[model samples]
Target: MAAVPALPVSLSGRFKGSFAYFTIKDRLPQILTRVIDTLHRHKNEFFEEHGEKGVEAEKRAISFLSKLRNELQTDKPVTPLEDELPDAALWNQYLDYQRNLPNGNGEPSWFQSPWLYVECYMYRRIHAALAQNPPIDNFDVFKEGKAQNFFESQEAVIALCTYFQELLKNIKDLDEKQLQEELFKLLQVSLWGNKCDLSFSAGEDSSQKSSPLQSLENMVPYILVNDMEKVWSLLVNAKKNRTERSNVRVDIILDNAGFELVSDLVLADFLLSSKLADEVYFHGKSIPWYVSDTTKHDFNWTIKQLGSANHMWMSRCGINWEGNLKKGVWVFHDHMFWTLPHDFSSMSEVASDLYAELQKSNLLLFKGDLNYRKLTGDRKWEYSVPFHQALNKFHPAPLCSLRTLKSDTQVGLKPGQGEQIQASESEWMGELIFILRHLIELQ
Candidate 1:
């Protein structure tokens, strides 16, 4: 295994009055409560489907989750996962690693350990609770919330689809400059779409209701870091040097399941439509994650919803996307590595296969704040620390992070910029200020 970097400390809930503490004390419990309620509300359905067996499974899963929630709330020692999932051994090994840390207490609890590790461990434990029982093994507790997010964002979805269709209609006639401008606009749209994250709201409704394209110009100033132009140039240059036009590949590591997903899909479609990328690969969580992260089911569900919509341009875009999937222009991948607690720097040693797959991409577009947190190891880094430095040794390909600042751990800012923002907007980091970063410093 790769040694942990000797850097700033990990963000932990042990520090009171911090965002990590708030997430552990308030948001996590709120999400757990909702999951429990959802299971309880489905008792009759379980009975109807699997009779007593299903009902028993539901009850057992709920009981396990309730206990897990209590452990988190009471700051009990983090226990080993008892279920026999494929990754159970790996998870326990990680726990051992935590116990062996230099600041070891022998028992890493919810509030005292790395916030990222504990937060991710909570979701993984939830999966194990359900999977331990037979009938409910494949159940997704967060499915209803994800569908609701998509349904609630229908208006914005239509608006975004309409704009994309218009762009496609004129894409062939546009000059190079116009293409770059359109790419920048879509990047901005994707960046801001990250605001609709259910986890940040503790499972509350947070769907986009306004037209995303219309807000780009107004929201430009809030973007603390904008590297869209550098991203565009890299794509253009790669295309110029390649003998085969169909060789360029772009990978999007997706985030939420609602409108943010729609935004990512549209961006992927545009990349193919404009010939900037010949193939776009999407990476999603293997399990339902963080209340809102995408899974294979969510990805297909969104496309199916779009294809079945009554609107003209929306349905056309959906049909086109469905066709793109059929033609292998767009691909979806779900790896267990994505759902694990490891940071990006450990991917080579821990998930060598996934890391090798990422290395084949010409450009990697990591979406949303969770991905940002993972990329930076969720550490307490200075604002002026360079983005590459924060990443430690993980650089599989030329990458860009399109994220909104919904967490306190941020890097790659000017000396005075972070201070200025902190003085003016006290809650700015958690309020979803747009941020974009390019990892071409190592290029």
Candidate 2:
């Protein structure tokens, strides 16, 4: 077991502000109240739409939610909880353990859990908070100004579309080798960019908001010069070994919207154009989640934004965008699999279906900080633990994680690296970003 670092004597003022304003005092309870009311308002309608079993499930869900809301509102003792729901027990256990941890103040704050559990807990708690705090009898937990700012930022969107146009044009002249090299460079850029993207400090906008792709307009020289060679070699080797002519499919478990989504799309496009993948499947949130997770609407809007650019660069990519969507090569799925209360352990139950679909794909890319938290089950892992070990049995497809560290759970650090970071008195695990890729065939 890894020794717990000595606790800081006083919580960082920023951390305190985050909990007081976002998690415990303001946003969470409000969100939970809205979720409860939504359930009640939708209960009869859901039953009418689905029938007896659906109604029963809805009722039971509402009951659990109501109790959860009450607990948050009253600041009740952490209940001895378990996720014994036939399908998601491990996830439940994780949550239960997180709630049971001792917070710095010796009273458990809702925010004090392993990264994965606390994040999910926050969302669930928000659902309950929204349910309890109805606004004139309607649920509107997502009324923050930033989300609106993102959608309204037409100039930023246009700038990204223009960039994509230029990239698409440049790709036409590249040989297969060059394409592969470009893909790798984009991947690194995407990975490094994540470090700047998470909300590490309270009151600060995430990296996605602060530095959009437009910020990188001047850095292309460094990217092409520094990252191109190694990626080219890897791509050449990968191509040479191909036995059967198989199309590579890339799956992205997507994250945040506005600028972050644009960056993700840029990388995805590079993968496809470079012949790294023939198709891209995007997995998105079922409901409003994580304050920034993409939804079906968000996905479509992104495509439209890319297509709307009149520049030649945008037009070339744009012309082919809808075609890919129609060919079923670019797909989006929003099943409960995404919103499952458990961590990747829940993947086991749906392994057959998930594996079948992913088996055809060459790579499965997971994005953002929250997904990283979930992938590792947000355990209090020794930072030195191997990534694969922390992943336990959840390996499916040739996978890579692109995440900016936002939470405490991390793995795959070098010897003594974890200790060094700790000695610095900095939030190293939470601020450093990583890109870990593993090919299933190699293992």
Candidate 3:
């Protein structure tokens, strides 16, 4: 793919006299102030631990963040300049889109550009925040706490793996109808897990704790399961039909860790038990990503969670889940494919590799908010645009996006549904949940 264009020179003027002024004047400054404070708090500790090199790196990071904040505030519009990474291209695209929009009344700033732009900008700002802060600057604030928790719970990881192995032992005994019901239960558990993710909201009351699996319980029944069932039958009925050899693999683009991973493991186990897929491949982020992304250690920690005798659900499932792991029917991988920017250009560049890996799978299940944002190219689409159209042919496998909308950019809404949502709810675009399934052949 050719290089993306630079940010337009007109963006500064576009925001200067408009209501969107908060983005520059208040929001950006507030973010910068917090960043600087975070940096100052950790500076001494970072220096003491790493010596001169750490101190110098922290200083340079702080300087860059300060300069970037100043650039945002300046009267002179800054056009895009090349950066060391392709992620910069997303910001450049945002600037271009925002500058070119026809000014009109009642347009929201969040809807003025593609979803990818705002999501990428948030990530960049988070990166800036870390850079400006010392010891914390060197660490990913999102992942550090989670990683620490995983390391401290080694026993939990082993037990979960053992449970999965045992679950596999009972697969041959389940009838088709029983298998379907079991799979639906697991899907419900996976859907509910989205509620636990912190990105959605910071609790207003310190004492209130949100259920991690709430959304799943709400969304599972709404899933128009005719399609999901058809897909399931296609995989499971292959032997009886005898028309072709069935060698199906299901890929789960994993989301959070802890309970979320446990829910996903439950779903994976069901898929194998139902004969919906012979094997399951879990794809995880390569970097410390969106708070609870699964690392190698987290993967092990999740397995342990599933096998523990004290885990009420696992004990009740009455299957030896651990046997599946030992048989190599379940596998885990962390790949760089996830770390790249969400754009058509980036998707196209990586298509060949993605296709190669996914060619072996019958279905790819992308979970949670960030994965959904990336899959849709994070662009603000006309509410009527078909979900497949927004994907821009990036489907490497027949895919199901099970997401609780945390950001905008939804497609496939029924006529007037979008408008009705806007009228009734202040933040419907980000609060609604969806299970958008697209078959490669359907496109």
What is candidate 1's lDDT per residue for 1-443, written digit by digit as tens?
Answer: 99865799999899898899999999999999999999999889889988999999999999998999999999999999887888889899999999999876568999999999999999998888788887878889999999999999999999999989988889999999999999998998898899989999988999899888887899989998888889998999878877754489999999999999999999999998899988999999999899999999999999999999999988998899899999998999999999999999999999999999999899999998999999999999999999999999789999999998888889999998999999988888777367988878535
Candidate 1 vs candidate 3: the lDDT winner is 1
Best lDDT among the predictions, by candidate number:
1
Give the candidate number with the greatest TM-score: 1
- How far is 86's C-alpha from truth in model 1 (Å)? 0.8
lDDT of 3 by residue, 85-178 (tens): 4455655665665566665212323323333443345446556545544544555544444544443433433344344446557767877776
Q: Against the hidden true structure, what lDDT does model 3 obtain?
A: 0.57
Which 10-residue window of candidate 1 scores lowest in summed lDDT? 237-246
Q: How big is the RMSD of model 3?
A: 7.3
> What lDDT does candidate 3 reach at residue 110?
36
**Residue range with the least summed lDDT across 10 consecutive positions in model 3:** 202-211
Query: Residue by residue across 240-325, what tens digits does model 2's lDDT show?
Result: 65567756567888876656666677777776776656678888876556655677877776677557756555555556777778
